[model samples]
Target chain A: MSEYQLPAQFEEFSQARKEGFLRAKAIKDSGGHIAGTFCTFTPCELMDAAGVHPVSLCGMSPEPIPAAEKDLPKNLCPLIKSSYGFAVSDTCPYTYFSDLIVGETTCDGKKKMYELLGRMKDVYILQLPQGIDRSYALEMWTKELHRFKAALEEKFNVTITDQALREAAELRNQLRQARTALMELQKLDPPPFTGLGLYKLLDGLGFSFDLHSNLKKLTDLTAQLQADYAAGARPVPPGQKRILVTGCPIGGVLEKTVKVVEENGGVVVCFENCGGIKPTRYLVDTQAEDIMSAIAQRYLNIGCAVMTPNSQRMELLPQLVEEFRVDGILEIELQTCHPYTVERYEIKKLAHDMGVPFLALDTDYSQSDVGQLTTRIAAFIEML
Target chain B: MPVYSIGVDIGSTCAKLAVVEDGRTLVHQMVMPTGWSSAETAQAIYDQLERQGYCPDSSPCVATGYGRLNVPYAQKTVTEITCHAKGAAFLFGTEACAIIDIGGQDTKVIAMADGVVQDFLMNDKCSAGTGRFLEIMANTLCVDPGTLCELARRGSGVSISSMCTVFAESEVISLIGSGTAKEDIAYGIVESIVNKVASQYGKLSVPGDRCYLTGGLCESPYILESLSRTLGLTVTSHPLARYAGAIGAALTAHGLARSERRTSV
Candidate 1:
């Protein structure tokens, strides 16, 4: 390890995943219900309202991939393969302890993988619409959320009242506000944390189960970073090209993409991917007459490539570029992920229109492409 | 006393060295086969510089290419993509143009404006559109790369569909077994490479009409013609195009040396 280390807050967040596993196991031991979720589109408020612990089950490693390949094809998305592999190998504690797994028809690869995952665990598939422009899309999605609520109620033997839903919505909205505040700290001239450090904290938040503690930790970290900045502490050097990363979820390949960018004289100031600002940018409407419909609208509006026309992503990108003062845009598409790969052309054109240099890279979860990634990222920094 | 800058490019297949005076005048240059080890090749380059009366201790040096980190004496290291763009701009004397560099392991399409790189695209983690693809096909056909290009010019009306180098080799074997003309098979191989490169170039939004070719295969007129025909643009190359990466590194070294001088004063 280098003599320079991440801040104590960052270290604690990095340890959240391992500690979360034990916390989740304890929850399961005490006859508590845990719901494993695969996409940001999953209504965690519904699970929270039913007094169930909602854990993100999207795999972020290459270890369980080979076991997944025994049942799934080799050329599918690595994220899908890793997620299914964990379920088949019985390795992930979250997947093992979950009373139910909630998946959505976001992409072809994942929806198929969920079919196989259902054999080992109780899996519920939510029929998601392809686009948000149509009138019936929201109605169908709201109905899906209702079905999901019903499923949760039947499985856990608990009634999710309107007041409970409202409370859950308010808590989730607070978490989003805390997350947004933490991420916005990168707008500082010289950011208080490295992009890698920021990404670790954001990715780690998914594994943490307690909503109140998660909100508290996020606000505390944001406050600490703001205080450090005011005290003349700059973790990232000035004049490093500020980069905005936009593409598929990058947790599995963060070391290759985000770490390489920081090491090569570029600091990723913003992430438009699933775990970053994409899902957290909107909040469920606690004051809506229909709380379930409000939750559906918030999730359906996420700027994921799975949506046709994907206008939300196109709309959100320029705002991030302007707000983050990005010097460059780096889009990472995992191999065989057709939606992000195909949508990259539009993103590149948008970046060009905004007069920022764009670089699109396609990679998998393996370490085989690290050298190439370094060279590409280094050259990009040099160009900036 | 005249100061000089040295640029060392340790590519996958060949190592090139260039010495420049004041960043504009090329004072010395050499090329050697990068056999087996890059560290050894870097040492050999330094020894050759010493013998040529160039002081490696005083000159500012920049290393580039796949083995750039192996150059122990270099003051800095830059990636081949940047080096190639800078060198191509200097050689072509055009600020607004597109460059296609077919390296041994990678093929890069770079767009430049005002003598700086605007955007670039490189082939994915495959040898489909690279110089290595042509080299492998040449070896399978029992001919050197140069002779293979020469033969490809004489044949017509055949194409290799496989995008993978390994699959393409087997396709070549089957074609040869069925008494297909060697020249025709060679044409198919070169055509496949040209098509792959052209497809990558098509994705890049360059500024101007000027397109230049650089790298080891730049000397091949047949490739230049095929690339131009496929891309629907005139693809041109210079005799020193193969050394573009080294020259770019040398230019960067000149900048480094000038900055150091300014800091010292």
Candidate 2:
């Protein structure tokens, strides 16, 4: 129904998106324990090393939020409500089949929702330290990572050896490398990818357990993108501005904004959310003597707004802006998301300092504001 | 012997059309309620304009506003934010200003400089600050929109604090039931709309003091007076403020047509 049709290769991912849970189901049936995580801070290497299937459990649909309202408040963050909604309604097999649901203390809404989720399934809480500059923060997170590794060993009854950790690290690094390689294609004029297309491919990483197959698909897709470029094929036409979206992660459930951005004549070239480049772009230094500590160091450097004094994020943005050739920045903060909302002013100031057009929009998962949201986004594109 | 570029703005409550010739002149303008069929209304307006000797094949047509996608013949669709800036700059000549557009379902505070849009913000999903909210309150008071604005102008000030439109309507009904004067309640409704708009405007970080009001709400004198008083700044509207979106769309169409002609040449 969108005015702009997605390129064929990206459309292929849409088919894969439909069978996401089935793939997870297949993995579960094959004697693999599925480990579901709420935040990207849950290192995939730890779970994979224990022969567990790691899947992201963030909910994207609003239909189940009413079911969630029985126990949760009506005005709670929509993502949290929708996630709990999926859990209660048994709509998400990933959550239902998860042997362990890993949660991080990224925000209060997710924290509280995870507490409620613990009643329904086995939940392991990751106590994330705020403000990386604090003297003991890195040490504290390192200890937490060890505890997390131990939990995986105890829950799965398999002692994780350094060799397995190294192997898992190598596997995940390959997946990350494939994703980062795909992202570089955005720097080209008339980016050979759509935001919706790129999102579908990256989101596949959340549910997919087999890194080698994903790398093959990505490698093949990248070749096709390069061929398209050589053949003078591009998804977005000239005069359409490139946008970099920053804010809440739009996972399986919260994807309308990306579609809306593309529909409104803007091509999303980069995403600063956890779902995109931030977590996947970095890799664990496998050569480090302690792979557990190396994984901790890598994730700790993630510049989420939950971190106090997130200067690394602020420092990284301008470089991304130049690298991606962004014409504007669209910062979307979900309703009741306090940390991102509080930090919105700083992002706004950054946009102004960089002299790029900016629009900070706050929305929930409800379809009511789609019209208004489209208008604002269109106007922002027109500005560019 | 001149071709006229056309722009149609199919808004939530009204559909507007503007025809421009020679890249500058506003040849014709039409405004009507959007009704159920935006595409039909836009087509009918286009037909009427075509009867006046405008050739469509040589001219570009642009559509904008909430129902923009429904405009069947649009060569391009732009957002009302761009249209408003273009329209305001045309009327006011590139002055650094904020264009405050209060439409049926939304209110947009757009910051512009040198005839270009720099930034903008729109009311969230709520209808509390929009023209539709005022229209609903007007219906409950058994008064037409024009009379309600006039009544507010003469009535004593009464505070109305409910943010949700449905609750605010209930609050209005209670005031009438409690022997409060209709005129006072009418004044409160106007103040409520003004308060909502002011709060949204306060959140804009774009630096500007000169504010221009556009959209159908500009026809309401009380809102303009209230806006000026609340913001403590000079607020003005172009004589054709209601046609801003259509005019901007028409201007863009003209530019597009010129580019096409140049490409062909």
What DockQ class does candidate 2 belong to?
A: medium
Please provide, for model 2 over A1-384, each residue's C-alpha lDDT reduced to its tens digit, 9 standing for 90 to 100. 323222233333445543655566566666778888878788878888888887877888787899999999998778889889978877676876788999999898899888999898999998999878988887898899889889999989998889998999998888788888898798887898888888887776555566788889888888899998999886677656899989887663345577777876778899888877787777899999878888888888888999889886798788889999999998888888899999998998998899888888788888777777777776777788
**Residue lDDT tens for model 1, B1-265:** 6679999999989999988888888788888989899999999999999999998767898899999989878888889988898889778898889999999988999998998888888888888989999999999999999899989999987889999999999999999999999899999999999999999898888897899999999899999999999999999999899998999999888867533421100
For all candidates, the clash counts are 0, 2
> How far off is residue A136 in model 1, in Å?
2.2
Q: How far off is each candidate at the interface, as Cα RMSD in Å?
A: 5.8, 6.0
RMSD of 1: 5.3
* Inter-residue clash pairs, candidate 1: none
Question: Over 4 Å off in model 2, which ranges?
Answer: A1-25, A252-255, B50-59, B206-208, B258-265
lDDT of 1: 0.89
Model 2: per-residue Cα lDDT over B81-163, one tens digit each: 88878887777665588989988888888888778887777887889988899889999999987788889988876888899
C-alpha lDDT (0 to 100) for residue B84 of candidate 1:
91
Error of 2 at B25 (Å): 2.6
